[model samples]
Target: MTTGQALVAVRDGTFLPGPCFMPCVDALLYRFRLVPRSILVMGPVGAPLLPP
Candidate 1:
């Protein structure tokens, strides 16, 4: 999906949008892993993993 569409999904609490292609795929992969939580960052550079 396009960034805008993904953003809408996130805003509507349906799904999260990653900032880039790789991260988006990663998110989809991990999503089925049953992780209790996740994070999504927004910026011109695209979504990147935040420092823990």
Candidate 2:
């Protein structure tokens, strides 16, 4: 999806539209790891994706 679409998704889910590190992919995955908050990152389909 485009940035606008992403922004809409973020807003719809009440998520922080932090920034898209990966522009090639549209899917954004959020998960809690090192902090007490959800961290957004690119999926494995994109570069430097998070491990499963």
Candidate 3:
């Protein structure tokens, strides 16, 4: 994939149970048209990952 534009992963809100909080993520899937130059998590911005 080629670099087209900057993209950020976002979610509307955290998960919740029937009557309580239950934060969770079904999965961490990165679906993009172009290859991202960098992917950031809890660490520094613009962190690099393995080349495709």
lDDT of 1: 0.50
lDDT of each: 0.50, 0.42, 0.26
Query: What is the per-residue lDDT of model 2 for residues 1-52, given as tens digits with 9 covering 90 to 100?
Result: 5999988887766533323533222332223233322222323335346333
Per-prediction TM-score: 0.26, 0.26, 0.12
Q: For residue 20, give model 2's deviation from the true position in Å.
A: 28
TM for candidate 2 is 0.26
lDDT of 3 at 31: 42
Q: Which 10 residues in a row give candidate 3 its minimum summed lDDT?
A: 18-27
What is the lDDT for 39 in model 1? 36
Model 2, position 42: C-alpha lDDT score: 26
Higher lDDT: candidate 2 or 3?
2
Evaluation by lDDT, superior candidate among 1 and 3: 1
In candidate 1, residue 29 scores what lDDT? 57
Error of 3 at 43 (Å): 4.2
